[model samples]
Target: IRAHHADLAKLLTSVKGVGPTTASTLLAQLPELGKLNRKQITALVGLAPMNRDSGTLRGQRHIFGGRADVRRVLFVAALVGTRFNPVLKAFYARLLAAGEPKKVALVACMHKLLVILNAIARSKSPWSNEIATVV
Candidate 1:
């Protein structure tokens, strides 16, 4: 039974506020890979960047608004992610200095976390740091 959601399950194990139930909800709500491109899938899950492309409108990366239930769990996980995930901690601090709301900064960190998960699932590797990538 469509157990690819198990990939999400595995990733969530190390994240906070992401027990089986929360991970299950995320999988249920996110787009199936066949239904959308990777970018689109991230957007559908409310994890992609948003742009306000127009004359002097000021483009910004807005958060996923696709599913409230899914987003709620993500918020909690995102909070914890900032504290524990090395990459997310740096991102969160940078975003905060840029004057983004605390919650918004947390959400941006969440997006980075999701992107990392996407790669981890594709590569079948455990989480590693940007430091590792660079060194």
Candidate 2:
């Protein structure tokens, strides 16, 4: 989208989990979100932790899966958000209080950020940090 639409790129990074890397990655993976729900969104961003278990191990869900490239970028954007974005800061703190692991909480945050990005794309709006609070 950003190739032809410089504005979307400018708008995207202003969102929580959308840095240059994630903004680009999302454009590639979720080429058509006109049909994705939150679940599909999660899978695309590679934030969906899988549940794998055997007999003795139980494998307590973790996030060693999903698209590594996308995950890499989203994770970085998520870290930035936790420190800088107000809504995400609160959301991260809430998830931590709920006893989720730090990594998991961050992933949850990424999921939310991705959803917002999708909405922006669908709605044909651009983002600006100055106006982030209004959203």
Candidate 3:
């Protein structure tokens, strides 16, 4: 797998929390990873919030309908990222400080992590903390 999608897999696993299994799952299951924009990619991975509302009534946005396998692996990676990755750790802390629930904060980290991976893949660049800071 890495032999074929070497750069993509390498770039993803370069992140603090992503492992070979997660990277492989992404490469195999999420072919649209680098091809889409942030919102598009997150939505594809089932990380983007879906609105549950009727006309003139804004309800809580929930995540649904995408690659469940990918989302499942991402959830595990995001949990590790919140502790090991400096940028993600800070982001997770900020979300908690703002009164976000633990699950919500973790999902948001998953979203951010996927976005950063997508950006790196699209640009054909290795992961960098400097670039991650911008996300």
Clash pairs detected, candidate 2: none
- Model 2 lDDT per residue over 23-133, tens place: 777666556543576677677656666777887877766656566776677778889989988878988999999999998898887776766676676666665543344
Q: Judged by lDDT against the true structure, how good is candidate 2?
A: 0.69
Quote the positional error of residue 52 for candidate 2 in Å. 2.9
Better of 1 and 3 by lDDT: 3
CA shift at 69, candidate 1, in angstroms?
2.2
Q: Candidate 2: lDDT of 103?
A: 80
Candidate with top TM-score is 3
By lDDT, who's the top model here?
A: 3
RMSD of each: 3.9, 4.0, 1.4
Error of 3 at 12 (Å): 1.1
Worst 10-residue lDDT window for candidate 1 reads 126-135
The whole-model C-alpha lDDT of candidate 1 against the native structure comes to 0.63
Against the true structure, what is each candidate's TM-score?
0.68, 0.73, 0.94
Kindly report which residue stretches of model 2 are placed more than 4 angstroms away from their true locations once superposed.
1-3, 33-35, 53-59, 127-135
- Estimate the TM-score for candidate 2: 0.73
| Residue 104 displacement in candidate 2 (angstroms) | 1.7
Segments of candidate 3 deviating more than 4 angstroms: none
